[model samples]
Target: MVTLFDLIVSGFVALVVLPLAVSSLVAGSPPPPPNMFLAKYYLAEPRLMLASNLFLLAVCATAIQRLATHFGVLSEPVSRSLDIWISVPFVVLLLAFLGLFIKAILTVRRANRAA
Candidate 1:
């Protein structure tokens, strides 16, 4: 179980660090075709893939922080069950969003190529 301090520290690092790491990873990839790829995300006016990664990472980090801190306050089965309840949904949401996003990108790429 994570302590409040551990949650805070790890969550902060996750919010700040993972996004930077993901940004670097995306930066190394070939740029998306104009705005088409990113437009499907949120507001969608215009933004970098790094922005999306940062946004998603921020959400996960916040949820993780909350979960960890909450877990620290509980005991035994309660803590463990709470941890599972909190973490599982967040993870599922994250995976769902990521899969959809990747699928959209590939669809766009294929269309762009076929055109």
Candidate 2:
């Protein structure tokens, strides 16, 4: 009962997301080319690229977990365990990002008010 959407998502994860995650984990971030305008930022903050790649991997993993559950590939208890483990970190990260975003906005507003 695989739908077109399922096939597309699985294909994207297998072909693109998985490879990018594996490469970033194994090789770390690659050095940006000298001619590239963003090379300075890349070199200055390599961890940002790694963190983003890991976040992408986490999202793909969560998608795959949901797909597996939908297909009955995972049992109830095991699926619940995986869900808890995978989802907790993802939720925490999401909240952390949201907090940072709000903090940034408030900081900017305060600065504007002061000026």
Candidate 3:
């Protein structure tokens, strides 16, 4: 009884959201003293911590929603809304990570060309 909407949501989560979450979690680790670049610009510890917590919440929400669906607990509208709401932090984190990634790339290229 999976609908097109369900398929699309699942695909988006699997393809994009999950990767971002895992990467953010990994990158969020405290950077070494010599690697201030990561701490200051790319993946600040505070941001990573927040993103990690949000990622946990997102996982829990998804699991709960799935279990509810299986047991016929939540309605379609409620489930849809939950999915959309849970995606907000992920999307924001994704944008932030992309911005930092681009900046890091450009900085590296510039440095390489200068040498």
Highest lDDT: which candidate?
A: 2
| Prediction 2 TM-score vs. true | 0.60
Selected candidate, larger lDDT, 1 vs 2? 2
Candidate 1 Cα outliers beyond 4 Å, as residue runs = 1-8, 11-72
TM-score ranking of the models: 2, 3, 1
Candidate 3 RMSD to the correct structure: 7.1
lDDT of 3 by residue, 20-92 (tens): 6566566664444655655443333334444444555466557567656655888888888978887786677
- Worst ten in a row by lDDT for model 3: 40-49
lDDT of 3: 0.61
Best by TM-score: 2
Worst 10 residues of 2 by lDDT: 39-48
TM-score against native, each model? 0.42, 0.60, 0.46
User: Residue 83, candidate 1: how far off, in angstroms?
Assistant: 1.5
